[model samples]
Target: MFKNAVQLFEIFGFKLRVDPSWLLIAALIVWSLSTSYFPEAVPGETRTLYTVLGIIAMLGMFLSLILHELSHSLVARSYGLKVGGITLFIFGGVAELEEEPHDPKSEFRIAVAGPLMSLFLAALFYGLTRLAADGTEIGLTGAVFGYLALINLVLAVFNLIPAFPLDGGRMLRAVIWQMTRDLLRATRISSRIGSAFGLFLMLTGAFAMFSGGGIGGFWQILIGFFILNASNGSYQNLLIKSALRGKTAQNLMSSRVHTIDPGASIAELVDDVMLRQGVSFVPVVSGERLLGYVDTAGAQSIDRSEWGMRRVADILVPASPENTAAPATPLDQVFKRIGLMPRRKLMIVEGQRLVGVISLSDLVHHLALEQEIGTSLRG
Candidate 1:
């Protein structure tokens, strides 16, 4: 979902994206509100009116989500962290920070920002609802605003439940980090708590289902599974980042990289380069200037018959800032950059000159070596 996200807009230098999966949530919200929520709240509204109200309410909720993520991005940026972007996915939105927080205080501030924004939105919507209701306007618009107010408040409260990967969970981790002065330890503790909370939620969901809670129970189950996955993923990511901390791209990059000329045919790349060298990736170059790269995956995209006709340059993915890492870039940061790309690889570059390449395999090997050394020391 993160990889497939489509950029919607840029807000204050932070890109806002929506994953295709988010469309499911949007559709569900519109369906639920139009069929049941608005009809019940407004009482005797036409089907068309209810549909419009539902759409407006869903958009309002989306706006609230944006505000929530925006607040987090702004705070993170204020603390000298890069806000990679915000991606709205199945559960909600996440503000991808380019690096971890430098301290517990920064983490706490960033984590708390989202819920605070939600709370503020809730109050604003409730106030507007009141203003509309006070003037004898008890219609679809008023009900929609009222629903938005309630949902935003619920969002705020749900996010504050001290579950890892959630806003509240980060706050919990921050507090633990502050206390222990160990970020990894703090993360582990928070993740364990989050996993437990997720299990509890799942059990509650099952109970609710048995008690005839219907769709709401299923929703709870879905949320619980999401939280569980997120908590586990958060811990694993921190582990990877921790292992690679302070290491530079130069330290781990495969300097003995294979290269293919821009004029080389894709067929030659496959037979003479990839097959002969047993290398999956090779840089495309013209003398000292780096052009891009070609991998087996890219090669396979061309029909075997057309491989002889296609130039390496034709299939070479042009080097972008995202796909290129400087020698001085932190290894973990390089990993982060590469993960955002489909190829899961990065070209090491200093200016236009290609130096080396790094792949997910390199990262795994480096991490394994670190663990081995740690184990030896402990032994």
Candidate 2:
């Protein structure tokens, strides 16, 4: 989702990235705090002093967000789930988990970790605010701490609202899932609540805007739309995963795959195989043994004149987990790997032999057929 995110740093093996949209939000936060919040909180502060305090407060909020997401990542890892990373976007930060929790208990714990951490930070900052108020001469330091404390408290409370995809929503899902023993049904119920909540926020924002709330109302509307979209997307993704649960690479792969001899010259590959067969990717095999694979990108990298001198071996990408999967590998795993590939293809290999290949188009076709036949793949 964060295609344009910039990596900041890693903590406890979790990489933190900031999306480009975050810069806009960061600027707004600084502007709001400097011009309005800090000035009102500390009445005698100069404009410059307020701006400085605003920047400091914004930085503190940034840290607070990271710590909140980090708590989720740490707990998810403890449950043996793979975390892709944490990304800060316009809305806020997210701990991207590669897979869902195996059980409702694990999901509950993972979802609750973030808000709990926020609450802890809120208490800690409140205590610091009191200390700073007693010792500081200008009271600026205390004001900043006070703001952070209040914001964190707000964060904790807002997330505790039972809306799907939110911490509270997930907690609600966990409770329902435990009672009903049906995850999909629980998700459906929670997501519907989330969507309703999002709609309510949108209507509330619209009313506030007409009532002269201005920018604040606009922001509420924007956040409401984001929540509405995210809740629906999360449910759809679960449905797709459910449909693919029992499938494997062998079930979806095309056995009649095109292969090129590694000894073949790059010129022959580009002319005879790529152009004639209209195939962009072909496995480089030597007597049924898979070596690597070559694609249009690899072929285009060489100068036209040098194509005659180079062999397929020279341009082939070495077989690796990124490009190849075992035939018995689960389809969901293959689906994830295929999405990462530029060509959206994966060679199904058995030991050193190339058995078949799978592509995104193949998966789409299969799903389409299942839908056409009125198969109820969803759990």
Candidate 3:
């Protein structure tokens, strides 16, 4: 829902991107107060007082979310992760770290820092209420400040719910990683835990919804849906990480490849096509070097079906730079590229000669193999 909110300002060199959805939340709060809370209070005095308190309450919440995120960003930066920015959204704020923490201690520090700051803010607000020194009746100022304090407390506890994409989940991942010494395995375990939490929240929300409890139940269902989606994404990310581990193209590349000469008799070349090299295309080459790849369909432009076209001079497609992959490239990067260009194939090459080909099917097969290995390892 965010637009261009990072333009808000720079806070200690950290950029902020407030999601546009936060405005929707603010609107909801105001509407809720006008319809429900405002109607019950005394007319003139209560209205003016609460109007100011409501504004203060909203501002306090925003400030609290920002402080919570700042705790995370500062710790993550100290530990060497690049803090991209902090985003304040409908639910809460998120500190965007460029990468996962390097160790469990670092992760635990980063995760706990947010909640601890929330607790501190809560305490600070409570202290201000008690030490007012003016002995003013616990009116709008007291009520709003008290409510804001409680909000921070609730935010802290709720975030510690041990669900992925949440602070607690990351802490869980960090602990498990420290124990198992395998990040992928740790991620898998934590994702499962988050997914379970999502299911539980969904069931609870569904029960609340079907009971006709109205707005509160509807909100529960909304939160449930968010948790469910986030958990599923976490699980998929683990699967991707698992498939990519320790994989090198050299181990799976095809060594036997066909090549076409830049200049050859078209009639004789047509005979090579009839032999069936088990590939739809062959790279055009000159003296053990690559030029480009040629397809049989292209040769048909010169009546190659009857004339037997052999020369790849103009028949080959241009060799694209992006289509090439290194033998030791990471599977995560490879898989990401494959999704962007489903029909594209990687030309695995050492120097000049065609080394192998990595197609969509190859990636699929690799994943299947990884699953089998994972199952075996677990067993």
Candidate 4:
């Protein structure tokens, strides 16, 4: 979901990234704390002092979020799953686990880790607050910590609510999976519950808005909409992955891909390949060696006037192993790559030779056909 995220730090072998959307939430927290939260709680303090405290509270919140996500990542890694780093966005943070948990036990551990970490932090903060003296500078710090402890405790409890894609939802799914030994069935059940919860949230938010809740209601509605959409998407993607299970790039890839000469100019590519051949992408090759892949989208980056001046190599996306998948690679893995890809395609390679190409369109078409066939059989 994070298109332009900046890597903030590398923690315990996992990269932590801050998405642009995080700034929105961060600003909201800072504003809410500075103007209302801190001012009301710690009266008689200067505006500057309140602002500083707000910032400090904000930082504490950020740390808590990181620890929560890190807990998930660390647990998943301990189970031998690939940790694709964490991204902090408007909805807080998510650890990008490359693959689903192998079993219900693993899933249960991973799902519960974040909330447990939050609860632990809450306890630690509460203990700190208890140790501090009252009516002093240290007491004010303790009060801030106490507030943080409360928020963290709330976070833990809120996350334990069984909603799909959320920690609680995953826990629900794990429990169901353990009972039935059917991951897909468990996912469907949890997702439906999540959708229901999302609808409830939306309705409650609407009612709150009509009753003068204003921004809080609006925020609830936004979160509800996000959860609803994400839950639906999660289920759909699960179905797609299940259908594509045991399938490989060779199952869906197109062998007859048009190749572009590295020496050819962008104008030539547009005229000959795009306009005539009706192909959006062409592999830029020097003999049998795969150099890169060029598309009309990349060509648009340069001025149309410069099309004749620049070579296809200048506009091509570099052929990295990361962008190329083996013919034997699972379709699910290919789908994951396409999600993160700028070009929205993968080159099917056998050793150093490009055997075929798999685009986003190909995978979607394949999945659609599979779904249709399954429906027909069921009917």
Candidate 5:
């Protein structure tokens, strides 16, 4: 994945964000093809021609991955989802959407669209391969075309595996959602399959390693690791979806919290902490309106000696409730938006004056309560 991919870039207005890691992967692919697939020692073939063909093929393959992701984005957009555009990474690509699909039919279309595009590409390459094979002078063209055709065919078939984080897994989720009419159940089942698939890949890779099967085994293990992380995310997302459904910021927020002004120093904050208003995190407010927030955690990031010297305005994170959200933001989303951020509490702003704070503890408690209620209902 990218360290931090840019949101957009103008490439004919169809923005492309290249993941940082994608650059490395693409370079490695190019090198592999240039040296391994194209060689000067081959009889009756020029190294330059093979090199050029290798570059072209690799470029085309990258573009193909982009198109696959674009297909997902466009379909989701047509269904009124907010798309954050497609990103190319080590595993290929992903079209980031703001929320999970609300309708099974919409989910089906979005999931199917990617592999369908790959199949179309496979056909195109196959036709080119056929045409080149008939032409005597274009042996290199035929080989490259043939490779593309076969690669795309592999892509299409591989993605059909019913496991989490794969297109096939997503398709399975859509089908299950349609059949059971339960999104959580569908996600749980599909992701569990994905995790199982990951374990299979890992085990195979380990066997291959001991058997001296070489780099292919290494790739399998790496892919298995990717699957493990991705499926875990999907499972965590299920919990978030559930958390979002039953609660709001108001439901989780602790009311009548203390406040901080822009002019206040960390020294002032440290003094407030001493009062133990039962507050680990405090809201930063100005006038009767809201600004952002300053957590004791953020203050801790600075040198304690500098605490008296630093103003809250210099360190406090300002947030607009419109841009920021109540704990009501899907719990998965809240964690994602505030990744590894200090103090999980998101300030709940109404008209400001520091109304309340919603901490992770609050969301966790609410989720536990909801589970208990559901259990009781079943009983």
Candidate 6:
């Protein structure tokens, strides 16, 4: 979901990525700590000392955030959920789960894992702070540890706030889901509450700004907007998931696929397939086996004069997970894949044999038809 994010490293088979926006937040944290927090907490420290301490503290906070998100990923994996990766963004971090929990209990466990991990880290840092402190002298080490302790406590408490997409909001949704046995209803109620809470925060922030609360007020407003957007997006995603439930790629793909031979010239592909049929992409096959695909872009990449000389195999975009899905793949998963792809399409395959092609337009048409016909796709 994040663009231009840098992959930091991999831990326990989970990739860790940091978005560029996070760099801005990280700099703000360092500056705030060096100028205000550290100087105040450790009096008489030099500017250089304070800066060094701030940098260390920032690094510690980064590790703490990773651990918090890692906890969530680990728990979800235990329940057989596929975690795409952990991404650190402007707000904090998120463990991207490929699919929702199968049941409320799994959901509750997954949602609560982060806060619980944060709480543990808070206790751990508090203990370290106590150990580093002298009887009457709280040195730089003690101060840094104390700050980490408090921040971890804050993170735990902040994430526990009942707002949709937040740990607490998700926990609330899980409880409601268990009680009512309706995941959709639970999500709708929690997301509405989350949106209301976001509105309240924005208003409070506006009041703070007018009352001279300064940058803090602006920060709160930004966070409020993020939460509001995320809440609505989460609800919409659930609706799509509900609509596609029990459906597979086979049900959504267009079986009337137009395939091209590997030896077909780019000129033939452009004129015969693309212009005549108005199709942008055509899969290249050797008998029944899928080799890859050639699109209008690939054909155009070659000069028009050389179109007749270049073959489809020479300009083929190799088939991979990004542009292909199994016939049995869930429609929701296919939908997500298509959204992420530049082509906005996927080839449905059975083993190495191409079965059909599914595009974003096809999925949209299916959803629109369902709504128009008032069809209930629920099992």
* TM-scores, each model vs. reference: 0.77, 0.81, 0.73, 0.81, 0.81, 0.81
175 in model 4: Cα distance from truth in Å?
0.7
List, in order, the clash count of every candidate structure: 0, 0, 1, 0, 1, 0
Displacement of the residue 66 alpha carbon in candidate 5, Å:
1.3
Model 1 sits at a Cα RMSD from the real structure of 5.0
By how many angstroms RMSD does model 3 differ from the true structure? Answer: 5.5
Segments of candidate 4 deviating more than 4 angstroms: 133-138, 255-326, 336-357, 375-379
After superposition, which runs of candidate 3 have C-alpha atoms over 4 Å from their true positions? 1-13, 20-23, 33-56, 130-144, 175-186, 249-323, 342-344, 349-354
Best by lDDT: 6
TM-score, candidate 6, is 0.81
What candidate 1 gets wrong by more than 4 Å, as runs, is 134-138, 253-329, 336-359, 371-379
Sort by lDDT, best first: what order? Answer: 6, 2, 4, 1, 5, 3
Report the lDDT of model 1 for residue 343: 77
Q: Which 10 consecutive positions of candidate 4 have the poorest summed lDDT?
A: 131-140
Q: Return whichever of 1 and 2 wins on TM-score.
A: 2
lDDT of each: 0.89, 0.90, 0.74, 0.89, 0.76, 0.91
User: In candidate 1, what are the lDDT values of residues 220-279, reduced to their tens digit?
Assistant: 999998899889988888878878888899998888888989999999999998999998
In model 2, which regions exceed 4 Å deviation? 130-138, 258-322, 368-379
Residues 1-379, model 2: lDDT tens digits: 7899999999999999999999888899999999998888788868999888888999999999999999899999999999999999998899999988888999899999999999999999999889888544428888899999998999889989999988999999999998998887898899999999999899999999999999899999998998898888888788668768899999999999878999899999989998999899999999989998999999899998999989999888988878999988998888888999989999999998999999999988876776556345453
Write candidate 3's Cα lDDT for 1-379 as tens digits: 2455545777878888777888888777666554455344323465556566566678788889999999999999898899988888777788877666888899889999999999998898887766642464545556666767788999888888788767888888889989999887787788778877877877787888788877777777777777778777766666766677677766665666667687865554555752555566666778767777666576667765545434567666765667667777776677767566534566677677677777777778877888888789989
lDDT of 6 by residue, 288-342 (tens): 9998898878887899999998889899988887888999899988987899987
Answer with 4 or 5, whichever has the higher lDDT: 4
Model 6 clash pairs? none
TM-score, cand. 1: 0.77
